[model samples]
Target chain A: MIRLLAKPVSAVWLLLMLATGLSWWLGLDQGMSSDQQSDYRYISSGLIIIAFIKVRIVIRYFMEVREAPLALKLICDAWLVLVSSAIIYLYCLGPVPVATGG
Target chain B: MTSADCFSAVERKVEIKPHVPGEVGVWVFILGDMLIFGLFFIVFVYYRGLNVELYSHSQATLNQNYGAINTLFLLASSWFVAMAVDDMRNKTVKLAPVFFPLAMLCGLGFGVVKIIEYREKISAGITITSNDFYMYYYIFTGLHFLHVLIGMGVLVFLWRRARFAATQADVRDGAVIEKDMVLIESGASYWHMVDLLWIVLFPLLYLLK
Candidate 1:
C-alpha cells in the first residue's frame, strides 16, 4: 500500500482532485445580487483555462503520455492549445445578435 | 521491498527509449476520439456564444453537486487504473487485480449519479428538446455515458487478465508477460481518455458562467 502511494501517479491523482474542487468552487454563484450587470468573462475564461490544465495533467500522467515520444507529446499539446484558445476566444467574444425578419 | 527502495528502483529503471504506453493504433484511436470531442466543445461554445444569456440561464438549472460528484468518481477511477498499471509493471499482479474492480465500482458510481441527475431533470420536464443547452447536455453526456459503459467492460477484461496472471505460477516474478503489456496499456489508455474528456465536459456544460 505504501508503495502504491509512493508512486508519482498518486501525487498526480491528489493534484487532480484538488483542481476539481477548485473548479467546482469557482463555478458556484457567489451571492452577487447586484442589479448592475457583472462581467463574468474573466471568471469563465479562468474556469475553462483551469479545466484544460487539468486535462493536460490527465493526459500526461494518467494516460502516461509523459513517457511518450516527442511526436505524440507535440500532438497532444497542440490539441490542448488549439481547443482551449478557440473556446476562450469565442466565449470572450460574447453574444452575437441574432438575425431576425428573415 | 520498502516503498523508498521501490521508488528508487523505478527511477533507476527509466531508460532513454521513447516509450509509448500503449500500441500505436490505440493512440491513433484515442487521439481521433479527442479530436472529435474537441470539435464538439468548440461547436457547443460557438452556439453558446451566440446566446450567452440562454446558456447561462440553462446552466443555472443544472445541479452542480451532481457534476462535481461525478467528476470525483471518474478521477478516482482513473487513479485506481493508473495504480493498477503501475503494479503490473512492477510485478505486483496480486494487488493489481484488486484495483480494477475498485475502478469499476467508481465507474458504476458515475453512472448511478448520472441516472439520478437525469431523473431529476426529466421529472422537472427538462428534456433535450426543452432548450439548446439541454440538447447539448443530453447528447454530450449521453455519449460520454456510453464510453463509461464500454470502459467498465474493459476494466472487467483487464481484471480477468490480471487474475490469470496472478494464478500463473510459472510466470517469473508474477509480472504479466511482455506480449500482454501492449493490450493492457491500450485498454488502460482508453479508460483514461474517457476520464479526460469528462474533465472538460463537466465544466463546459455544468459550470461555465
Candidate 2:
C-alpha cells in the first residue's frame, strides 16, 4: 500500500482527497462570525477557483491529458478558463453579496 | 521504494508520446458533453444571481455532507480507473482486473449515496417544484446520476475486458496489450469525464457561498 501511494497516479489521488477536504471545510459555516459574513463573497469566489483547479488536476493527471497532444491540451485548458472566468464574472456581477441570514 | 523512485520507475515505463489518451471519437463526445454542462452551469448561476436569497436559502436546506461524500466517491473511482489504465499500459495485468472492479464499487457507493440524498430531499417535501434552486438541484444531480449509472455499466464492460486481456497477455506478444489499451483508455476517459463534471457541479450546487 505504501508503494502504491508512491506511484504518480496515487499521489495525485492524495492531493485530490486533500483538496476535497479543504473545500468542504471552507464551505462550512465556521468562519462566518457576524462581522465576517460580508467577506464570504471573497470566500465563495475562492471556492470556485479552488474547484476549477481541482477540475484541471483531474483532467491533466487522472485523465492523462498531461501526455496528450498539444491540440487536446489546448482545448481542455480553453474550456477551463472560459467556464471558470464566466462563472466568476457572473457571480460577482450579481446585485449584492450573498445574505448569510445571521 | 521511495516516492521519487516509484515516480521515476513509472515515468520510465510510460513513453511520453504526444497522442490522444483514448479514441478521438470519444473525446469529441466528451468535449461536447462538457460544453452542454458548461452552459447549464452558466444558466443556473445567472438565474441564481437574480435571486441570491432564494437560491442560497434553498441551498442551505441541502445536506452538504452528501454532496461532499459523493465528490470523494467519484474522485476515488477516477483514481482507481487511472490505476487500472496504468497497470494495463505497463503490462502488469494482475492488478488491472482488480482495479476495475474497485472502481465500480466506488461508483456503486456514489449511486447509493445519491439515492439516499434524493430520498431525504423528497421526504422533506423538497421536490423539483419546491423552488428554482431545488429544480436545478434535482435536474443537474439527476442527470449526473444517470451518467454514473451508465458509467457503472461501462465499468462492468471494462472489467470483463480487462480480465480477458489479462488472461490473453501471457499467450500473446505485447501487441495484444497495446490493442486492448485503446478500448480501456476510452472507457477510462469517459469515467474520468463523469468525475470531472461532478467536480464542478458539487460546488455550484452545494458549496458555493
Candidate 3:
C-alpha cells in the first residue's frame, strides 16, 4: 500500500520539478524585457496551476486524505479548491486600487 | 478526606499519554497560521501578475540557483523526516539517532544557504523595501528561515532524548515507545508543513517568470 502511493506521489513531484526547470529555462531565454509582460503572466499562471495541481495530489493521496472520513476529506478538498479558485480569479481581475485623487 | 489525602489522589489521577495537549493544540493553531500565509501568497502573486515587468525585473535580483538548491534540500529533508517518523511508529528507536541528526543537518544546511543568499542580496543593494517584490521576498523567506531554526532546535532536543531514552527498559516497553512516536510524528508533520510551504514559495518567487 505504501509503495502504491509513494510511486505515483514521487512521479507527480518529479513532473512538477521538470516543469519548473523548463519554465526557468524559458524565463531565462525570454530575458528581462518590458515587452514580455503578457508572456510572463501566461507562463506564470500556467506554472501556478501546475503547482496547485501537484499540491492537491500530494495532500489528497500522499497525505492519505483519501482514506480519511468522508466529511473531513470533503472539507479539506473543498477548502483548497475554493481558496485556489478565488485567488486565481482575483489574479485575473487585476489589482483594485482605492480612488483618492479622482 | 484530609488535605494530604486529596493531594495524593490528585497526583495519582494526573494524565500521561502519547499525545501532548500542548503539541496537539499547536496543530489547531497552525490552521489559522496557514490561512494567513495563504493570503500573503495570493497577494504576492496577484501583484506580480498585475505588474509582470516590474516583478520579473525585481525577481532578477534574486539568485535562482540558490533558491533551486534550497528547494532540493528541503524536499530531501522532508523525505528523511517522514521516514524517521515511520521508523518511530515501528518502534525502531535506534534509527532515531541516525535520522534525527540527518534531519537536523539538513535544517542547518538550509539556514547556511539562506544566510549566504541574504548576504548576497544585501550586498547587491536590494533591501527589503527596495521594491514591492523584495518586501514580500524578505518577509516570506525570513519567516520561513525562523521556522527552520525553531524546527532544528526541536529536532536536536528530541534527538538527544530519543538516544538516551532508548536505553531505558521503560522506553523499550510499548508505552514510552508510543509516546515517542507521537512526538516524532508531530515534529515530522511540522517539518513537512515547512517543506510544503517552500515548495509553493519556490515556484512563486523563483521559478516563475
Candidate 4:
C-alpha cells in the first residue's frame, strides 16, 4: 500500500483522499459552545485552502497538465488558487454591505 | 524528396512536439469551461456574503458523508484514468481495456451515490427551492452530475475503442491504435475536469464553515 502511494500519481490521489477526511472533521467541529457560535473564518479559510490543494493535484496529476506545456499548467494552477482564494476572502468578509443610491 | 529527407522531417516533428494534452483544442475548451465555472463560484460567494446566516443555516443541513463518498469515488475514477494513460504511454496497450472499465465503474459509483443523496434530500422535503443554499447546491451539483453522466458515455466509448488495442488487427493497422489512444486521452482529460469541479464543490458545499 505504501509502495503504491509512493508513485507520484498515486500519492496525489492518497493526499486528496486524506485532505477530504481532514476537511470533513474540520467542518464537524463548531469550535465553540452554542451561546458563542459564530462564523469561523479560520475553519472556512482552511477548507478553501484544502479545496485549492485538491484541485491543483487533480489538474496536475489526473488531467496530465504537468505533461502539457507550461502555459496550460499556469492557466490551471492560477484558476484553482484565484477562485478558491476569492471564495475564502468573501467568506471571511461576513456580509456584503449594500450601497445606497444617491 | 529522398526517403532519408522524409524520415528527417518526421524526426523534426517529433523533436518539436506541441505540448498540449489530448488535443490543443480540448485544452482551449477546458480553460474556457474553468473560466465560466470560476465566474459562477465568484458570483456564489458574493451572494453568500449578502446572506451569511441563511447560507450557513442551509449549509448545516447538508450531509457531509455523502459528499465524502462521492469525492472518494471520483478520485478513484480519476486515478484509474491516469493509470490507463500511463499504460498507453508505456506502450502496454493490452492494459487499456482493464483500466478504462474500472474507471467507468468508479464513475458509475459516484453517479449512484449522488442520485441517492439527491433522493434523500427530496424525500426529506428538501429541494432546490427550499432555500438559497439548497438552490446553489442543486444547481452546481446537478450540473456536475450531468457532466459525470456525459463523462460516463465518453468512458464507454473509450472502453470499446481500447479493446482494439489488444486485438490482432492493431498489429496490422498501426493507425487504429494511435487513433484510439488519442480519443481515450481526450476523454480521460474531460473526465478529470469533472473530478476537479467536484473537488472544489465538496468543500464549498459540505465541509466549509
The TM-scores that each candidate's chain B achieves against the reference are 0.90, 0.92, 0.84, 0.87
Instruction: For every candidate, give the share of true A-B contacts it also has.
Output: 0.92, 0.78, 0.20, 0.82
Tens digits of per-residue lDDT for model 1, B82-121: 8887766655466778999999999999999999999999
Q: State chain A's TM-score for model 1.
A: 0.85
TM-score (chain B) for candidate 3 is: 0.84
Query: CA shift at B125, candidate 1, in angstroms?
Result: 1.0
**lDDT of model 1, residue A51:** 89
C-alpha lDDT of residue B94 in model 2: 76
State the lDDT of candidate 3 residue by residue for A1-102, as single tens digits: 366237544565566567556655654546555554556556656766766675665454334345445664665567577666766676666532222234
Instruction: Give per-residue CA lDDT, model 1, range A1-102, as digits (tens).
Output: 888787788988888899999999988887755431243556678889998999999999998888889999999999999999999998778653333234
* Model 1 chain B: worst 10 consecutive residues (lDDT sum): B169-178
| DockQ of candidate 2, scored on C-alphas against the true complex (2 decimals) | 0.79
Candidate 2 Cα outliers beyond 4 Å, as residue runs: A98-102, B1-16
Off by over 4 Å in 1: A35-39, A96-102, B1-16, B169-176
Question: What is the lDDT of every predicted structure here?
Answer: 0.86, 0.87, 0.65, 0.77
Categorize the docking of model 2: medium
> Model 4: which docking level applies?
medium
Best candidate (score: TM-score): 2
Per-residue lDDT of candidate 3, residues B18-109 (tens digit):
23322555555545556777888888877876786687678877778787778667755655565555445444355667878887877878
Q: Residue A101's C-alpha lDDT in candidate 4? A: 40
Tell me the tens digit of each residue's lDDT in model 2 across B1-209: 99999986665343547779889999999999999999999999899999988998999888888889999999999988998888777764778899899999999999999999999889988899988999999899999999999999999999998888788765554457777787888899999999999989988998877
